[model samples]
Target: MITELKNIKKSFGSTDVLKGIDLTIEDGEFVAIVGPSGCGKTTLLKILAGFERPTSGELLMDDALMNRVPPEQRNISLVFQSFALWPHMKVKEQVAFPLKHHRFVSEAFKKQPDVRVEEMLSAMSMSHLADRYPHELSGGQKQRVAIARALSPAPALILMDEPLSSLDAKLRIELRYEIQKIHRQFKKAIVYVTHDQGEALAMADKIVVMNAGKIEQIGTPQEIYYYPETPFVADFVGKANLLEGTWDNDQFSPALSPNVSWHFPKVSTSFKQAGLCPLRPEQLKPTADNQHGIEVEIQNVQFQGREMIYTALANETQLTIVSDADTRIQIGERLLVGT
Candidate 1:
C-alpha cells in the first residue's frame, strides 16, 4: 500500500466526524471518496495530508508511522474546489511558488522540476498564457493552473476536494478528460473527494461510499453500480428505478400496480420479504412484442437532443424510458414495458 489509514476517528466537541475510517490506497490508483454534504470526506483527506491529526488512529506512508508530520512534509498535494491561485502572480510564478518556498535546492542541480514547469503548462494547454496573471484567466484556465501547480511539486499523492465543481458542466466534462490523462502520464495516486456521483463514476478506479462520517462500502465503479451492497450504495451511485417486490420461491413479485413478476436464477439460500429491485432506466425498455412487459400509456415526451425521454404511467407509478431520437412516439400513446 502506498498509504494506509487505520481506525481513523475525529470528533468536534460533542458531535462525531469520521468514525473509524480504515482506508488503504494502492500506488497509482484513483480513489474517490463521496457522500452527502458534511459527511467528513474532506476531513479524511486532511488527515491523510497530515493537516489535522486524527483524534484516534494511525496513518502510515511506505510503512513508516506519520501521525504528527506537518502538511508540507507528507509528500501530499491538495487541489481545492476554489482555485487558490495568487491573483497577482503570473501562471509560471504561481506554479513555481511551492518549489521556491521549499527551497528544493534544485536551482543549481540538473534533472530537477525547473525543467518541469513548461512541460506541465504544455500538458494543461496553458503555455501560451504562462506570463498572464490569474485574474486574466478564465475559471477553467485558472483551475488548470491550480492543477498544474499541485502536480509541479512531484508529490506522491494528490488530494482533490471537489476540484471540478467550480467549472460549468461543459468545462467539467472537458477537464475530466485532462485530469485522467495527467494521471495516466504521471502515475500518481489520487484521493479525490466529491459530492457529485457522476464525477466519481467517471473518474474513479475504486469508490469509497461514505455516510454519517463512515465508509458504507468500497468497490470498483462497475461493482458498485451493478451490485450495490446496501440501500445507501444503491441510491447514491446512480439513478435507480426502485421497485418494491416480494420473493416467491424463484421469482420476484412486485407490490405495485401493473405488477411485475421477474424470475432470477435460483441460489443456495432463499430470501422472501419486502425488498427493492433497482433497475436502471435503460433496463426498462418499451417493446410492443413481449408477454412479460406491462402495458402502459405514454404520458409525456421530452425531446432532448441525441435522445428522447419517454415518461409513462402505470399502476400510478411514473416510469422513465430512455430511447434514441429515432424512437417515434406521441403523447398519450399506448406503449409496452419490459421490466
Candidate 2:
C-alpha cells in the first residue's frame, strides 16, 4: 500500500496541531517519524489510521482518497504503546480475534483461525504460552502477543506508535530486532512513530524529523545524521554543536578560531545564511596542533566503557567531544580541538 498525505492539516478549535503535513510511504517501506513531545507525530499517525480526520488535505492509498474512511474500513493494523489486549482473552485467542473480525483478513486466515493463530504465535515465540492470559504473561510476552495479533490478519500496512516505550531498555532492544524481522518477513509498509532518535536511526529506512508541528527534514538515517539541513535536525538527531562562523562560499571560518577554515560545500543555505556550522561530537577531536585547531579548556569528563565524553569551553562557548577512553586529559587542561 502506497500511502500519501498532501497538505494535511489538523486543528483543535484555536490551536493547530498539524500544520500542513506532506509525506509518502512506499510499498513495503519502513518509515519512522521522530520528534519531541507535542510535535504532532501521534496525531499524524491517528490521521493515517482513520481515527482522526484531516481538517484540509488529501489522504490517498494507492491513489484512492480515504480521508473520510473509518478505522475499520482501512486495510491497516495499529499496534499501540499500551498493549490494548483483553484481559480475559488468552494469547491464542488474542491472535485469533483479528483473523476472525478484521475486514481485510485473508480467506485462508478466516477459514482456519486456529491454525493461523498457532502460526502467528509460533513466529513470535509465544506458542508455549498460548494459553496464558495477559495478566499471567511478562511485559515482553504481552507485547509479543500484541504484535502477533496485529500481524495475524495480514494487513497491507502496520502502524506502530511507540510500541516499545513501555519496556525496559534491554527488552526494547530485543523488540526492535523482532519488529525489523517481522517487517522483512511480512513485506508490509510500516509507519512507526517514536521520540527516540536511536530507534529511528537503527530501524527506519526513511526518517522524518518533525518539530513544532512541522517537518524539519526527511531522509535516510545516514543523510539525516551526516548532513542535517537545519539546526534543529542537527541538534535533535545527532547532538551536533552549532558554532558561530563566517561563510565565504564553501569555506567557513569559525569565530573562535579565525585561522581555521573548513570547506563544506554540502551545507544547506540556511546554515550558511545564519553564519553557523553544525559539527557532531564525533567530528571534532583534541589535538596539539594549535595552528590548525581551536583552543578549548576541558571542563568535565565522563567515562563510558569504550569512550570518553568531554565537555569543553572555547571562548566561553561550550562544546562536547567524544574521545578515546585511553586518552589522558584532565579537567581544566587546555587542548586544541580540530576536525
Candidate 3:
C-alpha cells in the first residue's frame, strides 16, 4: 500500500470529524474520497497531505510513519477545488513555485525525470496559456494550469479536492477526460476529494464513499453505482428510487399498497431487511425485456430530445425512467413499468 491510515481520528473543538478511518490505498491507484458537505472529506485530505495533525491514530506511507512529517517533506502534492494560483505570478512561475520555495536545485533536478514545467503545460494542453495571467484565462484554462502546476514535479501522490467544481458543466466533463489522460501519463497514486457523485463515478479507479466522517462504502464505480453496500451509498451515490421492501427468495416485495415487489437477479451485498431497495431511473421502465414488470400510471413525460425521462406513479411511489420508446404520455394514463 502506498498510503495507509490505521484507526485515524480527528476532532475540532468538540466535534469529532474522522472516526477510525482505516484505509489502504494502492500505489498508482486513482482513489476518490466522496461525501456530503461537512463530512470531513477535506479534513481527511488535509491529514493525509500532512497539513493537519490527527488527534490520534497513525498514518503511514509505505510503512513509514507520516504523522511526524511536515507537509512539503511528505512529498505529496495537493490540488484544491479553487485554483489557488498566484494572481501576480506568470504560469511558469506558478508551476515552478514548489521548486523555488525550497531552492533544491541539483544536477539530477536539472536533468529531471519525464516531468518539467514546459512538459506539464504540454500535458495539460496549457502551453499557450503559460504566458497569460490568471485573470486573463477562462475557468477551465485556469483549472488546467493549476493541475499542470500540481503535476509539474511528478510527486508520488496527488490530492485533488474537487478541482473541476469551478468549471462549467461542459468544461468539467471535458477536463475529466484530460485528468484521466494525465493520470495514465503519470501513473501516480491520487487521493481525490469531491461531493459530486458523477465526478467521482467518472474519474475514480476506486471510490471511498464517506458519510458523517465514516466510510460507508469503498469500491469501483460499477460496484458503488450498481451494488451499493449501504443505505447512504445507495441514496447518495446517484439518483435512486428507494422502494421500501422485504426480501424473500432473492426477491423483494415493496411495501406499496398494490402488492408491489421485484425479483432481482442477484442480492445486494448489504441487503438490510425491510430497508430501502434502490432502483436507478434506467431500471424502472414502461416495458421490461423480461417477464418481471410493474404496473404504474404515467405521471409526467419530459421530452429531452434524445432519451426522454418518463415519470410514473405506482401505488403512491414515484418512479423516474430514462427511455427512448415512442410513447406519448398523458397525465393519468396507466403504464407497466419494470425491468
Candidate 4:
C-alpha cells in the first residue's frame, strides 16, 4: 500500500465530521470518495493532504506515520475545485513553482526545472499557453495548468477536491479523459473527492461511498452499482428503488403486494434484516399481465433520446422506472409493473 488511513476520526467541537474512516490506496490507484454534502468527503481529503489532523488513529505513508506532518513536508499535491492558480504567474511559472519550492523535489528536476516544466506543460497540452496569465486563460485551461503543476513534482500521492466541479458540462467530460490519460502516463496514486456520482463512476477504479460521516461501502464501480451492501449505497450510488419487503430464504415478498415474491440469493444480510429489496430502474418493467406483478399508477414521464424515465406510485410508495423510448405509457395510466 502507498497510503493507509486507520480508524481515522475527526471532529470540530461537538460536530463529528469523519467517524472511523479506514482506507488504503495502492500505488497508481485512482480512488474516488463520493457522498452527499456534509458527508465529510472534503474533510477526509483535507486530512489526507495534511491540512487537518485527525482526532485519533494512525495515518501511514510508506509505512511511516504522517498524522502530525505538515502539508509542505508531505510528498503530496492538492488540486482544489476553484483552480487555485496564481493570478500573477504565467502558465510556465505555475508549473515550475513546485520544483523550485517543494522540499521533496528530486535532484534531476531541481537541476533542470525548465525542462521539467516544459514536459509537464506538454503532458497537459498547456504548452501553447505557456506565457499566458490566469486571467488570459479559460477555465479549462486554468484547471489544466493546475493539474500540470500538481504533476510536475512527481508526488507519491495526489489529492483532488472536486477538480472538475467548476467547469461546464462539456469541459468536464473532456477533462475527465485528460485526467485519466495523465494518470495512466504518470502512474501516480490519486485520492479524488467529488459529489458527482457520474464522474466517480466513469473515472475511478475504486469507489468509496459515504453518508452521515461514515463509509457506506467501498468497491469497484461495478460492485458498488450492481451489488450494494447497504440500502444507503443502493439508493445513493445506483439510485435503486428500495421496496419494503419480507424475506423467506432467497425469496422476497414486497409489502405492497404480498402475493409477489422475488428470488434473489445474493442480497446482503443487512438488506434482508431490514426487510428491504432494491430494484434498479431498468429492472422494473411494465407488463400487461396483471396476476404476476405490482399494481402501479404512472405519475410522470420523461422522454430522453434513447430511453424514457418514469415516476410511478404503488400503494403510496413512489418508484422510478426506465424503459426504452418506444414503450410509451401515458401519465395517470394504471399498469402492472414487474421485474
Candidate 5:
C-alpha cells in the first residue's frame, strides 16, 4: 500500500466532520471520494495533505507514521478547487516554483531551470502561454498551470479537492481527460475528492462513496453501480427506482400493489421478508402485450437526446424509466410495466 488511513476521525468543537474514515491507496492508483455537500470529503482530502490533523487514529505512508508531519514536509502535492495561482508570477515561473523550492537538479545538471519549465508546460499544452500571468490566462489555462506545478515536484502522492468543479461544462470535460492522461504519464497515487458521480465513475479505478460522515461503500465502478450495498448508495450512485416490497417464494411483491410481483430466481432464502428492491431506470420496460405485468399510466415524458425519460404512476407509486428515444410512448397512455 502506498498510503493507508486507519480509522481516521476528525471533529470541530461539537460537530463531527469525519467519522472514522478508513481507506487505502495503492501505488499509481486513482481513487475518488464522492458524496454530497457537507459530507467531509474535502476534510478527508485535507487530512491526507496534512492541512488538518485527525482527532484520532493513524496516517501511514509507506509504513511511516505521518500524524505530526507538516504539509510542506509530507512530500505531497495539492491541487485546490479554486486553482490557487499567484497573480504576479508568469506561467513558466509558476510551473518552476516547486522545482526551485525543492532545489531539484536535473540528471547530469545539463538543462537549465527554464528548460525544465518548458517541458512541463509543453506536456500540458501551455508552452504558448509561458510568459502570461494568471490574469491573462483563461480558467482552463490556469487549471493546467496548477496541475503542472503540482506534478513538477515529483511527489509520491497527489491530493486533488474538486479541481474541475470550478470550470464550465466543456472545460471540465476537457480538463478531466487531461488529468487522466497526466496520471498515466506520471504514475503517481492520486486521491481525488468530488461531488459529481459521473466524474468518479468515468475516471476512478476505485470509488469511495461517503454519506454524512462515514463511508457507505468502496468498490469498482461496476460494483458500485450494479450492486450497491445500501439504499442511499443505490439512489446516490445512479438513478435507481427503489420499490418497497416483501420477498417470498423467490418473488418480490410491492407493498403498494401486492397483486404485482417480480420473480427472482437467485434471491437468497434468508431475505424472504420485507426489504427494498432497487431497479435501474433502464431495467424497467414498458410492454403492451404482457398481460401479467403491472398496469401503469404514463404521467410525463421528456426527450433526452439519446434516450427518453418517463415518469409513470401505478397504484399511487411513482416510478421513473429510461428508454431509447425511438420508443413509442406518450403521456396519458396506459401501459404494462415489466422487468
Candidate 6:
C-alpha cells in the first residue's frame, strides 16, 4: 500500500505543530520519523493514523482520500509507548481482542480465536505467557503482546509511537530486532516515530528528520548521516562538529579561527557562501607529523571500550576526534589533527 501526505499542516490555538509536511511511504517500507520532543513527529504520525485531522492538506492511501476517515476505519494499527494492554485480560485474550472486534477471523476459525491468538503469540515468542495477565508479564512480554494485538487485524499499515521507550537499554535493543522481524513477516508499511537517532539509524529504510514542525531532511540512513542537506539535520541526526565559516577560493576558513582553513574537494559556486561545515568525530584523525595538518592541543581524552574520544582545541575552536583506543595520547599534549 502507498500512503502520501501532501502539504500537511496542523495547528492548535495558534500553535502550529506540523508545517507543510509532504511525505510518501511506499509499499512495505520502514520509515522512521525522528526528532526532539515537540518537533511534531508524533503529530505527523497521528495524521497518518487518522487519530488527528490536519488543519490543511491531503492524506491519500492508495489514491483514496483518508482525511475524514476515523481511526478505526483506516485499516491501520497503532502501537503506543505505553503498551496499552487490558489489565484484566490474559495475554491470549488481549491478542484475540482485535480479531474478534474487527471480525478478521476466517469462517473456519470464527469459533476459535485461540487458534489465531496462539499463532501470533508463538510468532512473537510469547506463547509461554498466553494465560498470564498484564501484571504478571515482564515489560518486554507486555510489549510483544501489544504488538500481537496490533497485528491481529492484519492492517495495511502499522504506526508505532516510541513503542520501546519504556524498556531498559538491552530490552530495547532486543525488541527493535523483533519489531523488524514482525514488519518483514507482515509485509506492511510502517511509520515508526522515535526521538532516538540510533533507533532510526539502525532500523529504518528511510529516515525523516524534523525540527520545529518542519522536515529538515529525508533520506536513507547513510545519506542522512553523511550528506545532511541542512545544518539542523547534520547536527541532530548524528555526532557532527559544525564549523561556521566563509567559503572563498575553494577553501572554508573558520570564522572563529581565521588561521584554520579546510580545502573542499569539489567546491560548487552555487553553494551558500557562508554556512556551517559539518565534520563527524570519526572524520578527524591524529597525526604525529604537523607538516600539513591542523595543529591542535589535546584538552581531554576518554577511553571508550572500542575507541578513544579526544577533545582538542585548535586556537579557540574545540574539536572532537574518535580514534583507536591503543593510540597513545595524553592531556595537554600537542598534536596535528586532520581529516
- Please name the candidate that would achieve the greatest TM-score relative to the true structure: 2
RMSD of 5: 2.6
Q: What residue runs in model 2 are displaced by over 4 Å at the alpha carbon?
A: none
Summarize candidate 1's per-residue lDDT along 1-339 as a digit string, tens digits.
399999999998888998999989998999999999888998888888778888998899999888998886777778989999887899988877776654232453224555678878988999999999988999999999999988886678889989999889999999999999999999989999999999899999999999999998898998888767666777688866666667767676666632567765531131234366666666777765544666778888999899888888867877777778888789998767775
Error of 5 at 290 (Å): 4.3
Q: For candidate 1, list the clashing residue pairs, or say none.
A: none
Model 1 residue 44 CA deviation (Å) reads 1.6
Lowest lDDT sum, 10 consecutive residues, model 3, at 101-110
lDDT score for candidate 1 against the true structure: 0.82
Model 4: lDDT to the true structure: 0.93
When superposed on Cα atoms, how far off is each prediction in RMSD?
Answer: 3.0, 1.1, 2.6, 1.4, 2.6, 2.5
Name the lDDT value of residue 100 in candidate 5.
67
TM-score of each: 0.89, 0.98, 0.91, 0.96, 0.92, 0.92
lDDT of 4 by residue, 44-125 (tens): 9988988899999899999999999999999999898999999999999999999999888999999999999999999999
Candidate with better TM-score, 2 vs 4: 2
lDDT for every model?
0.82, 0.92, 0.82, 0.93, 0.86, 0.85
Give per-residue lDDT, candidate 4, residue 132.
96
Model 6: runs farther than 4 Å from truth?
Answer: 103-112, 246-272, 288-292
Residue pairs clashing, model 2: none
Candidate 2 lDDT at 317 equals 96
Q: Per-residue lDDT for 1-339 in model 3, tens only?
A: 389999999999999999889888899999999999999889999999888999999999989999978887876787888899899988877887765543233345456532477788899888777788899988888888888877766677889988988778899899999999999999989998988899889999999999898999899999999888777888899878887777777667666632555767655756646466788887876664324566778778788776678778878888887776575667788867765
Stretches of candidate 3 exceeding 4 Å from the true structure: 102-107, 111-115, 257-261, 288-291, 325-328
lDDT of 2 by residue, 102-171 (tens): 9989898888899988888888889999999999998999999999999999998999999999999999
Ten contiguous residues minimizing lDDT sum, candidate 2? 283-292
Error of 3 at 189 (Å): 1.1
Q: How close is candidate 1 to the true structure, as a TM-score?
A: 0.89
